[model samples]
Target chain A: MMLEFIQHLVNGLSLGSIYALIALGYTMVFGVLQLINFAHGDVYMLGAYIGMYTAHFFQLGQNSSVLALIFTITVSMITCAVVGFLIEKFAYRPLRKSPRINVLITAIGVSLFLEFSGQLLFGPDPKFFPQIFKPSGDWSIGELKINPLQILVFFISIILMSVLQTIIFKTRLGRAMRAVSFNHDLASLMGIPTHRIISYTFMLGSGLAGAAGVLVGLTYPKIDPLMGTMPGLKAFVAAVLGGIGNITGAVIGAMTLGLAEEFLVGYWAPTYRDALAFGILILILLFKPTGLFGVKQTEKV
Target chain B: MKLLFSSNSRHGIASLRNWILALVLIWMAHFFVADEIDPYFFSIIMYAGINIILAVSLNVVNGFSGQFSMGHAGFMSVGGYISAFATTQLETIYPEWFAHSFLMSLFFIFILVLAGLGAGFVGILVGLPSLRLKGDYLAIVTLGFGEIIRVFILNIDTIGGARGLPNIPALSSFGLLYSWVVITIFCIWRLVNSAQGRDFLAVREDEIAAEAMGVNTTQAKVRAFVVGAFFAGVAGALFAHYLRYLNPQTFDFNRSFEIIIMVVLGGMGSLTGSVLAAVFLTAIREALRSLQELTRIDFRMIIYSLMLILLMLTRPNGLLGTRELIDFIPNGSRKKKKSLESHP
Candidate 1:
């Protein structure tokens, strides 16, 4: 029983890390624009497709190591950054001054557009991830076993998240982003170039989502147009759980959600895993509404 | 608070006239359309009727009330299950009456009404807490609620699990569906044009301001959700009987979005607009059926989604905006939809 618990904990951490990566995109965009950016998940879906292609063309899937995975993640992130940039430029930017609901509806439209078009372009069938890094089998400690792919997913996600933190807090552009998130009009009044900062936020957030897509593929190995739907929703729940706009809150919320889901799948019914996250979302919104780490602001009546 | 058939209001007369005309048209459809119409065409018309009900009901919450609800399909699915379960259980007890009889049809309508009430109850549960949250949060919570319903239904074994509940009795006829549609539109139209409806519109325009005006914004918002849920439930019951199957997947977020698209495209808060868009979109979708078959790809959904974004960019007020179709029916009476602050 103890070994099984340890195994689920490890599994949870790895899964939570990917969710955190995606949740960052959701939280960042909501922080800056107050738009949920529903297409962010589909952006992650595109990332996996990009990674798959890069692997196929470069012949890196077979007999490749960490370098192959690194290159693939880099290419996917760059491509996804471009995709995210265009989406924000066209889909969202046009409705900046519109009612928040219009932007939201447009976001949903973009999400559906990406999902269906992905099916059109990528074909409806699920593709097997190229397996750039071999799984290296299982390593056992006592009765508990750890999968190397899960370890890789965990290590990569942590490193990326830490880098994100440093950039957001440590750099000049990062400070600009924070300022923009604080107040869009005020930041613009202060000559912060709000549009450019918003663009940068999308790029950074979407880049992380892309990285997550690749990592998820590395672990799960199956990729499809519809793959983003469930994970995207769960990641949004994670973001909400963490206190929507709070960066660190996203990670913590995602970890909690991951552990709960993994434990449910491990001991309880697997079918309830998706519902549990949403159930948590409703409860959190009902009681707290601000999320675990989110700072509350009094609404202007 | 009394609306529709109440003889006091000036607008009531016009709406009552419209309802009578709708009733006549439905009667005409039962006799003319049902018998002479091609089966394919008849089916499309039936679907259009269902879409009309769904769109108008959704418009109650999204259009008139100003609360963004993305989980209407969840309410609809709940209602569908309720009616389906009750009827199926009733079938075992009264196999002969459930087969082909006036008694069975009456019982079916009763079950559908019950479904609407059941769904409305669930909507209250979804809406009460949701009202405390603001715009985007409300939308997300509703979205989650819809997914939770779907996931919950998927886990249940009695309702056929992931495979879906099948073998629902087909009781939908031209008269039945449009009668419900007309009633739904009439009820919603009356509700919106009523004294209470002004509060709903006010809540939509500005919740804080509405609250200050003693509107009881929470009650108004919940009212919208409940009413919307109730009609969505009715629509679901009709839809289940029409299709004679129940896949929880059918009522996923996509279905809710499609209904939203209809409400938006028809011009939010416009009852006639909802009807027009429902018919127009259903027709367009039916036409697109050939394209889907030819390409074997779902470009129809792609186009529908793209149109939503483009429409929002160009005309966020939707095609008809806030004006009624009756405003255009008479010569020189057609007036432009007032450009509200929400649009700009």
Candidate 2:
């Protein structure tokens, strides 16, 4: 039982970190645009499929595994960043001045378009994600066992998150992003190119989501066109849980959600697992709409 | 009070007569119109009624109250299952109870109301919490509520789990479904014209300003949710009884988006638009069913998504926007007056 408990914890954190990565992307775009961007999930799905193809072509698992992993991640990230940028430019940019509901509908349209297009292109079958890194054996401490891949997943996620934090806080572009998110009109008045910042934000967010897509494949090793639907929704829940618009809060929320889900599956019926994330979402929205890390912004009359 | 009530008495009597005359006409169509149509065309008309009810109800919260809720499918499934279980179980145990056509129809109406209330009860649970939020947050929360409902329903073994409760008696005939559709559209239309309904629009237009003007935005929003969910439940009952099966999967987020698409395709705040779009979209989809299988390009949905994107890009105001159909009629200046009052 103790071993089982530890197993759940390690697995949960690994899963949570991936959610955090995806959630961070969600929160960043939301922070700047105030748009829900439902198609973000499909973007992540596209990332995984792209990663899968790159790994397959390069024979990532058969030769120079680490280099192969790096190449796969880079290719997927760049491709997804471009896709995200184009989505904003063509689909969302025109509707930026429109009502929130209108943009949301367009996002829904984009989401369906991507899913169906992916289905038509990818054939709706789940492919075994190429394991670029050979298992280096598990280490056992007393009754508990931990895999090296789990540790790598944890470290990689932390590195990416820290890098994102630096970009959002320490860089000039980050400053512009913060400025844009705060007030678009004022930011533009202050000579910040608001539209450019919005595009960059989408690219950055999509790139993070791509990294998450790869990491999730590394963990689960199964990729499908529809795989991102649940994770994307869960990551959105995580972002909200941590208080949307708060970067650190998103990580915390994702971890909390990941652990909660694992524990739910470990102790209760597995069927309740999916419902648990959404249940937490409702409770948080009602009780703490600002989220664990969010500062409530008052409505300006 | 006497002056206010008496000034419209003559017109009120004439309108009441017209309503009765229309009802009698519809009742006659039940015998003649319903029986004459082929099943394929009949299904299309029935589905149009269902979609209209769903769309119009959704408009109260989304179009009027300005909340971007996406949980109608969840509420719908709840009502569908409840009415399915209650009516089917009652039939299984006491087969003779709903034997007479007149008595059975009344019983089915009761069941639909019960289901609507069941759905509305869930709506309160969802609305009370989600109503506190605004904009996209509300949308996600509502969506989360929908997933929660679907997951919950999916786990319950007694209700057939993931398989779905099957073999429900097809008690929702054309007349029955049509009447409920008329009833739903009428009730919501009346609500849209009420003083409180105006408050719903105020909240939608500008929540902060509406609050400043002393409108209870929360009350108005929640009223939209309850009224909308109530009709969604009724629609659910009609849908389940008509299909004679209840699958939890039938009420997924896709279904919710489909209804939203219809509402937006019609015109957010226009009743006539919702009805027309429901009919139009359904007809188009039905006509394309064969081509969908033949071409295998998934062109129908691709075209749909493209329409949604281009519609927002070019005509985000939707087909009719905020204008009711009556406003287009030459003599219906009362609608013009109402529009001016609401907007002003």
> Pairs clashing in candidate 2?
none
Give Cα-based local distance difference scores for all models. Answer: 0.88, 0.85
Off by over 4 Å in 2: A61-64, A136-143, B1-14, B291-299, B338-344
Q: What tens digits encode model 1's per-residue C-alpha lDDT throughout B246-278?
A: 998898888888998899888887888899999
Top candidate by DockQ: 1
Task: Estimate the TM-score for candidate 1.
Answer: 0.96
DockQ of each: 0.72, 0.59
True contacts kept of 1: 0.78
Compute each candidate's TM-score over C-alphas.
Answer: 0.96, 0.94
Candidate 2's DockQ is 0.59
lDDT of 1 at B163: 95
Residue B128 of model 1 has an lDDT of 89
Q: What docking grade applies to model 2?
A: medium
